[model samples]
Target: MVDRRVHEGEAVIERAVVDGRPVDADARLALDARYGHFTALQVRARRVRGLDLHVERLQSANRELFGAELPRPEVLGAIRAVLGDDLRDASVRVYVVAGDRPRVLATAAPPTEAPTGPWSVTPVVYQRYLAHVKQAYGFQQAHIGRQVARAGFDEALLTTEDGLISEGSITNLGAFDGERLLWPDAPMLHGITMRLMERMDVPQERRPLRAADLPRLGQVFLCNSWGLMPVGRVDDVPLRQDGKLMTRLHEHYDAVSWDPLD
Candidate 1:
C-alpha cells in the first residue's frame, strides 16, 4: 500500500549526500532531541487503523522499555503534520539512534498487500534482545528480505530461539495445526495488528512449533499492523495456493470492528 509519491521522495533523499565531517556535541544533542531516545518508531499503515492506537502502543512500549512514561514526543504529531493531506492509507517509520542526540526519520508509505500463494520461509534462530520493543532493529529483516529475494520467495518467517515460529520480518506468524490457529506462546513481542485480530475473537493458540511440524500445517500466513498476508510458498515446499482460509480470515479482519486494549 506504499504511496507512489512517498517512494519517490525516499529515492530522492537516498541519492542526496551532505559534505561535512559531522557536527559537534551541542549540535548533536540538538539533533537527537528532535527524534527522542528510541532507535526507531513505527506506526502501522492499516492495522491499528487510527492515530490513537499508534500513540497508545508507543506509550506502552516506552514504559516497558524505559521504566518511565513516554514524554509525548512530538514525533507522532510531526508524522501526522507532515503527511497531512497526502496520507490516507500508509504506514510510518521513524528511526532515532542514540548519540550526542537522537536522529529521527519519518516515512508514511502504503501497506503491504496479501500474498497470492502458499509460502516457504527460513526462521532466524536467535532473538533481538529488545523483541518487546518496536524500534528500528531491522537488520534481521533486511537480511531475510535479501535471502527471500535471492531464493525467489515472498518473505521471511522467523521462529523464536525455542523453535516456535514467532513472526515474520515485518509481520507476526500464524499457522493452523490441524485443530486451531497456533501462535507462538512465550515471552515474545505482541504486535498491535495481531492483538486487534485476537480481540475480534480469532481463535489462536500459543505453542512451540518445530521444524518437523511444518508438514502438518493446514494453512500459514503473516500478520502485522498492516494486515494478514497469505504465504504463497515456503523454502522449497509449497502449500495450496487458492488460499481460501487465509482469504476469509483476511476479509473478516477487514470488516470487523476494533478498540485498542493496550
Candidate 2:
C-alpha cells in the first residue's frame, strides 16, 4: 500500500510521487507546469478502461516532445505506485518532463463528478499547437473555458481559421446525424475514450464540420476520458439531446473491460 494522507479543507486532494519518491506540493506543481506531456484518466477499484491506449499516448507524446522513449513497464509501475490500493474511484495524471535527466510524475485524487450537461457552448477561433500531442496547455484551455463561462456557456468549442469546428477546450466533439457519428477532420487529440468508442464498432466518419453545419446535425455530444455527455446548444443554436444516442454510447462505454492498474 502507498501512503495516503489528507490536507484539511481540501475538496480534491492529490498525492504525487516523482520517480519513486513522494514530492512536496511545490515540486509537484513545478513539474506539472513545466514543459512536459501528460495523460489523465479515471481509475475505479484500481482498474482503468483503455489502459493500453493511455500508455501508448504517453509514449507517443514523450517521443514527439522529448525525443525519448518511455518504457511501458516503467510507466505502468509509476501509475500503480501512485494509485496503490486506495482507489475507490479516482482521477490519475501521468506527467513526463524532458531534461538532462527525465522525470516522471504521477498524481491521483478522488474523481470529480462527471458534468451533467445539456451543455451550451460558444465557438472560439483558435487551434492548438502540435494538436496531436497532449502537452501542458492548461493555461490557454482554462482561459477560454473561463471566458465561455462568463458568457453563460458551459464550455468553448475551438474552431480553425476557416470556421470549421474542431474540438472543445478539454472535450472532443462528436456529431450524430441520425444514421452515423461524425468526427471533425481537423488536428485534434484523439482521446482514448473516442478510440474506445470506435473500437466498439460505433459507426463514425471523419470530415470537416463547419459552423453552418451545426443546425443540420441531428445531435451533438462531448466526450473525454471521464465519459460521454450530451450537448444542447452551440452558440445560439439549440441541438437535440438524443436520448437514444446517449443510451447507446453509455452502454458501449460501460461494456469496455477494465485493466488493473498494474
Candidate 3:
C-alpha cells in the first residue's frame, strides 16, 4: 500500500537477504524511492455520485484477485481515518499493498480539469494479464498512457484482437450512432461508470464495433467515475466538437442516488 502524505512522510523499503549477505542496498533503495511500493486505486465522487459503485467494484475485485474478501467498511474506514473531512466533494484514492505490513494511502484531490471541448482518442489493443484487482503489480497500463500521449491524443480506447472496443486506458469508451450508446458486444471489463449507467436503464447497445465503422459514427464519448467526455476525433477521422451527448449522459448520471458505505 502507498499513500500521499497526510503530514510528514518518509519512503520505506524491505531489504532482501541472500546467504546472510544483504542484497544490493543501492538498487533496493532506488526501487523503493521511485515506486513507494504500494497498491493503486482511482476514485471520484462529485456530489457523492457513484461512490457505492466504486467501493463495491473494489470489493468484488479484491475477492476475485486475492481470495481474501476485503470489506467496504475496512476500505472506507481507512479513507476516513486518513483524509478526515477533506474528502468532501472531491476525488479520493485509497491505495494498500502487501509489504511487511500493508501500506495505506488516502488522498483527496480535485478531479481532472476536463476540457470543455470534445477530445479525440485512439483505440489500442491490449489485454490486462490479471483480470481483477487494482494492485500496482505491473505497468502495462502506464505504457499504454505513454503510447497514447506520444500519438498526440487525450486517451486510448482498448479493444480485443478481433476489433471489439473494450474500454479506454483510464476511462470507458462509449460509441454513439445518432440515437444510442454502444458497449462491446462480447466480454469486456465492467467499468463503474458504465455499470451505473446500465443500472439506471440508460439506453446502451452491447454489440461489436469495428475500426472501419469510425467514419460512419455520429459522435463518440468516454465515460468513467470522473465524467462523461465527448470525443471530437479518432485518429485522422474528425467530427464536430460539441459534447451534447456527453452532457446529457452526465446530467442523468449525476441525478442518480448512491451513498458510499460509512
Top lDDT model:
2
Between 1 and 3, whose lDDT is larger? 3
Put the candidates in lDDT order, highest first. 2, 3, 1
Tell me which of candidates 1 and 2 scores higher on lDDT. Answer: 2
Model 1 spans with C-alpha error above 4 angstroms: 1-51, 66-68, 71-76, 94-105, 110-112, 160-162, 177-179, 240-242, 257-262
lDDT of 3: 0.56
Span of ten consecutive residues with least summed lDDT in model 3: 1-10
**Error of model 3, residue 175, in angstroms:** 1.9
Off by over 4 Å in 2: 1-11
Kindly report which residue stretches of model 3 are placed more than 4 angstroms away from their true locations once superposed. Answer: 1-47, 100-104, 132-138, 200-202, 240-244, 258-262
lDDT per residue (tens digit) for residues 43-76 in model 3: 3442345666666766666555455566667766
Q: What TM-score fits each model?
A: 0.69, 0.91, 0.73
Task: For each candidate in the order shown, give its overall lDDT on alpha carbons.
Answer: 0.52, 0.78, 0.56
On the 0 to 100 scale, the lDDT of residue 33 in model 2 is 57
Q: Give one digit per residue, the lDDT tens place, for model 2 in 1-262.
A: 1011111112354678888578888887677557888888888887889999999999998888888889998888888878766665778888897555678888887775456768787889989988888876367876777677778877778998888888888889988777688999999989998888886565679999976787788788888876887888888888877788788778988999999865
